[model samples]
Target: MKLALRKIRLLVHLLHGMWVVATRFPKATVQQRDALNRAWSLRFLQLAGMRLVVHNDAARLDEGVLVVSNHISWIDIYVINAWRPTRFVSKAEVRQWPVVGWLAEQLGTVFLQREKRSDAKRIMHELADHLVAGHAICVFPEGTTSDGRELLPFHANLFQATVSASRPVQPICLYYEDAHGNQSTAPAYIDDLSLGESLDALLRGAPLTAHVYVCDPLAPGAERRVLAAEAQAAVQQALDRLQPVTARPAREAVGVQPPEPRVDVPHASHAGDAPAANGPLTQ
Candidate 1:
């Protein structure tokens, strides 16, 4: 297909998604919302000119669970939603992003102001409530996106709420691949690139694939920090096997250093607080 024609078709799909979001999405019931989230996210990926490759080993959740993963790009949300519906705890700035923001809010994303320590309490409380109420929630514990090549030290505080509520933590590993199956930068929203810039790169390049690997869920431990470390290790090991080392400019062992303990959360919940728990899952 001609590049121009593909882009034109992509634009139409994008506009149609926007229309649905503006009209029916916000008014939808929970089931309806889940359907719409999957549909809209799939369409959004098509519009953005990327493909999704998911390998889910996640255990079936009959009740609400906490979803934790590394942050990479805005596309991560769409990729995950294309699989199942879950509310995400995102930064407050996302609410201002024109059309996208409205769609995100309708999809039930919880916002937190990262700068405010107090906001952590409120956000964690809400997340715990949702978990207890049987609603799945996702959190990016790295606190921000990495270059899609390197992993970041995860913030442990995010796990406290779920641990406190006795909810299990599910870790997912994400990778981007090129049409040739090599790790690709075609979809990296890293560095200082704007959303439009990322979109342009995706549309103009070879088809990109977003790969998701679901790790074994870590049961709530005595300490949130230990749980966070164990989760990070799970994700890192998965990446080591699945993500090609040649894809990155850095050395093979990425994000393997013991991160300086930077727990910035007020202690309130969970005998699950991690002092660390270990799970046996590898890529």
Candidate 2:
């Protein structure tokens, strides 16, 4: 019954979205139109049972900026879109997902082919064009999803897009909370769980909450590698300070381990990170 309601809501949203796209395609500036479209997407996610907590830093986010964020659950896209207008730099396979693929295309997502070295230049060029056109593009530099307890090291390659375009890179942190107010562990790896299993877990879990923190955009002129590292550090700091206090039993919580001693610059990026675009969106 819930699934049936969700389908009905999605169909309504799709129809409304198509109407808006057709009506405003020629009249509205890209920013104005995208802001409205993204807002609707966010509202749909909220109706689908995702709660959002957002923190906006000093960054104005005006003009074209490369927004870097950590990936956690499949719904991170909706969480991000709820707050601002932005396009995503995703894996090419997302261009084929069922309804999601259609939505992504409408959102103007830039699809990357990571396995093909030759595609890097093309992806970079496409990214540069988006920046030049004054569109905000979101990239998951960690290149994959994690359990929300720690951040993965960002891939320096995507930072090159910001460097080449001479645009600021905004760092964002995302954390997902479970029913017991703890981080979820079931949906980290794309290959670790089947779609049915993941959906079941989400449906059975307590209302999921996503916390989003936007840090100041990095200044231009720094090395892309240094910029990436700095962004990674900022995101880690936000996560450390903002993770909600969990009330779940120790054995049942996903991130119940004791906090470690503080370090000046803790390693946020985990090793052996998988590609970000590998799950249902890719299929």
Candidate 1: RMSD to truth? 11.2
TM-score of decoy 2: 0.77
Candidate 2 residue lDDT tens string, 191-255? 57765566555545536666677777897555779988999988876676566444332323454
Give, for candidate 2, the lowest lDDT window spanning 10 residues. 270-279
Model 1: runs farther than 4 Å from truth? 1-12, 58-62, 245-283
Best candidate according to lDDT: 1
The number of clashing residue pairs in each candidate reads 9, 2
Give the per-residue Cα lDDT of candidate 2 at 258.
36
Q: Evaluate all candidate structures by whole-model CA lDDT and list the values in order.
A: 0.68, 0.65
Against the hidden reference, what TM-scores do the models get? 0.81, 0.77
